[model samples]
Target: MDKKATVQKSGMILPRDLSERSWERIGSSLRELTNSSAWWLADWLIFGEATYGWRRYREAIERTGLDYQTLRNYAWVARRFEHHRRRDSLSFAHHAEVTRLSPPEQDYWLRKAEQQKWSRNELRKAVRASLAEQTRELSPSQSNGDEKQEVTQLSESAGADKRRKVARLTIELSPGQLDYYSKVAAAHGLSVDKWVTQVLDAAERRTA
Candidate 1:
C-alpha cells in the first residue's frame, strides 16, 4: 500500500494539516478585509478611545500589538477629510503623510498621489518639498540676511565657487538611535544629509 495514496484515499486531515488549511483560509480573508476595513476600524477605535479616554484605548491597542501613532493618524484623516470619498484610493501611510497639512492641502496632495501613483517615499519627498516652499515663502527674510551669509561662509572657503562642495562625515549609532534619527528626518521632510547639515548649521549659529 502506498502511504500517500492511502492517506489521500482515506480523506484524513491531520492536526497540523488542518491548522495550516484553516490559517490559509483565514489569512486570505484578513488580507481582503484589511485592504478596506483597517483604516475604518482604526478610525472607529480612535473615536471610542477619545470618547472614553486613553486608558481604555491604550489597553485595546496594547492587546493587538498595533502602534498608537498609526491609529491616531487614521483617526485624524477620518475626521479631517470625512467628506472626501477619494481618500480610499490611498493607503494609511499615504494619508498619514499629509495629516500635518490643512484640509485643502491634504486634499491637494492626496489627489496628486492618486494621479501619479506615487510610492510612500516619493510622496514624502513631494510633501517635504511643498512644506519647504511654503516656509520659504512665509519667511523670505529668514532665508536671507545674516543667517544666509553665515551659512555660506561656514560651508565654503575663500576662492571657492558660490556652490560649496558637499562634505562627507561618518558616525556610528545604535539601532535605536538610528531609528529615531530616521524618524526625525522624515518628520522634517529632509534626507539624512540635509537634516544633518541643518543640525550642524544650527549648532554653528548658536556658537557664533
Candidate 2:
C-alpha cells in the first residue's frame, strides 16, 4: 500500500489490549504525579516524558535540586523552545554545555515564547505542528530569517519599475463628487485612493 493508505489503515485499526495497558500505565503515572500541580507542570511532565532525552533532563533536575515549582517553570520554557523548533523543523540542542545564546537568538525565541505564552503540552503540540523546514533559506550569518525579505528584495524594485511604466488613470471629479468620495473613504477608514479601488472592485463584482 502507499504511505497515505498505510496511515489511513493504521488510523482505522483499533488498539489492542497491550496498547491500552501501556497507555493506562503512562496516563496513570502522569495523573498521579501531576494532578496536584499546575496545568503547566502537568503539560511539561507529559511532554518531557513522551519525548526522548529524559535521562539528561532527570540529571539536570537531580543536580539542581529544583523544587517542583521551578521544574514546572523549566518545563514551560522547554515547551516553548521545542514548540518553535518543531514548527520550524529546526534542531536545537537540549540545555547542555552552558552555551550562551546570541543576541538575535535570544530576542527571537524570547519574543516567540512571550507571544505564545504556551503551556508545556501546547508548546509540544506547536512543535509537532511546525513546518518540515523553515520557509526562509538562511545563511549562517543572517539572524532574521523572514523569507519575505528575499522576495521583497528581488521583486519590489522590479515591481515598482513596472508600476511606474504604467499610465495612471486621470478622471475629472466634480466638487460634489469629490466631497462625497472623501466622506465615504473616511467612513470606511480608507485613504481616498484605496476607497476608489474598493468602489471599483465592488462595481466589478456586481457586474460579474
Candidate 3:
C-alpha cells in the first residue's frame, strides 16, 4: 500500500508493484478479520438485544448489513455459550456445532475439539455420531422420532461441507519455549499446539 492508501478512507489501494510478502500479509490479516467477525458480531448483537429489546433487530440489520436471520442465529449461539464457556482454540463455527447440546455436553465436545484441534466439520461429525448412537439406543416411538428430527436439523444447520483445502503451518520453538507452552496448555487441559494457536488467535482478535 502507498502512504496515500493508509490515509484513504474510501478504500485501500495496493501499490502497483506490491511485494508478494506484503500481499500475503494482507491476506493473512483479512482471514483473521473474517474469522473474528463472527464472534464480534454475535457479541454485539447479544448486547444490543439485551439493551434495546426487539427494536435492536432493526438497528442491527441497518448498522451491520447482515440479514435478520443471520443476526438471529448469531445471537442464539452467543446465548448458548456464556463468555467463560467459549473455546478460544476453536472458531465460532465450532461452538455453533454444539449449540443444541446441553451445557455440559457443549463443554465436553468443545474441550475435545480444543485438545484434538479438530476442524469445524470434524467436530460436527463427532457430534452427529454421538447423537446417532443415542438415536439407535432408543425404541421406535414418537419421542425417538423427534430426537432423530432434531439430529437432522443440527446436521442441516451446519450447511454444506465443501471441505476446503487446509494449509498446515509449522513453527519452530526452543526447548524452554516448548516446556512453557506445554505447562500452560496443560493448565488449560489443551495440547501445546492448540494452546499456541489459541494464544495467537486471541492476539489477532485483539488487534482486529
Candidate 4:
C-alpha cells in the first residue's frame, strides 16, 4: 500500500505532491487499467450470463451501476471476438467499431488498426467510409443488408476457389470508361475486376 499512489476499482487516488517517478508510474498503471477494464467487464458479463441466464443482467446492473444497454453492447462485442482473436494493441472500443463487420473483416480491420495505430473514432470513420463505398457500388435500390453481404462475399471470393460453374464475359470499354472504373474501384479499395463483378451482381439483383 504505497501512500504515494492508489489504484482501486472505484478509481485512482493519488497524492497532490507525488514525485515525478511516482506520477509516471501511476499514469502507466492507469493506462493499463483503462485499456483492460472493458475486456474485464465484458468477460465478466459473458460468464455471468452463461452461468445465471437472464438474471445476470439484473444483478450486474444493480452491482456495477452501469447502463444496461451499454453493458449488453459490450458483451455483444466480446462474444464476437474470442480470447485468441482479440488484439492486444487495440482497445475494446476498436473491436466494438468492427462488430458490424464480417468475421474475416473483423480480423482485417483490427490488424490494420493495430499496425496503423488508429484511434477508435478513426476506425469508426474508416468503417463508415468503407460501408458507404460498398453501398454506392451497389445501387440505391439495394438494402444495407444486401450491401453488407456483397462486401462479405467480395472478401470471401477473393481467396476462395471457385468450384461451381463459371461463365466468362468480355466487354469492350472506351478509354474514358476504363479510367472511370479504375478510379471508382481504387477509391473503394477494390480492383477493377472485382468492381465489375460487384456492379454486375447488383444489377442482376435489381432486375430479379
Per-model C-alpha lDDT, please?
Answer: 0.61, 0.43, 0.68, 0.71
**Could you give candidate 1's per-residue lDDT for residues 1-208 as a string of tens digits?**
2122123554633353345556576666656567557577666776778787989878877888877777776676666656454466677677778877644456667777898999778999998986686465333211233222111212322245576454434444554554566557656645344566678889878998
State how far residue 56 of model 1 sits from its true place (Å): 3.6
- TM-scores, each model vs. reference: 0.44, 0.21, 0.55, 0.61
Residue 9 shift from truth in candidate 4, angstroms: 6.8
**Poorest 10 consecutive residues by lDDT, candidate 3:** 149-158
Name the top lDDT candidate.
4
Score residue 36 of candidate 2 by CA lDDT: 29
Better of 1 and 2 by lDDT: 1
lDDT of 2 by residue, 89-185 (tens): 2212222111143222333333454466644455444433432222232112222343311111111112644752322344445545555665665
The best candidate in terms of TM-score: 4
Order of the predicted models by TM-score, top scorer first: 4, 3, 1, 2
> Candidate 1's C-alpha lDDT?
0.61
Tell me model 4's lDDT, rounded to 2 decimals. Answer: 0.71
Per-residue lDDT value at 14 in model 2:
29
For model 1, name the residue pairs that clash: none
Name the regions of candidate 1 deviating beyond 4 angstroms.
1-37, 60-70, 73-77, 83-86, 140-208
Greater lDDT among 1 and 4 belongs to 4
CA shift at 133, candidate 4, in angstroms? Answer: 1.8
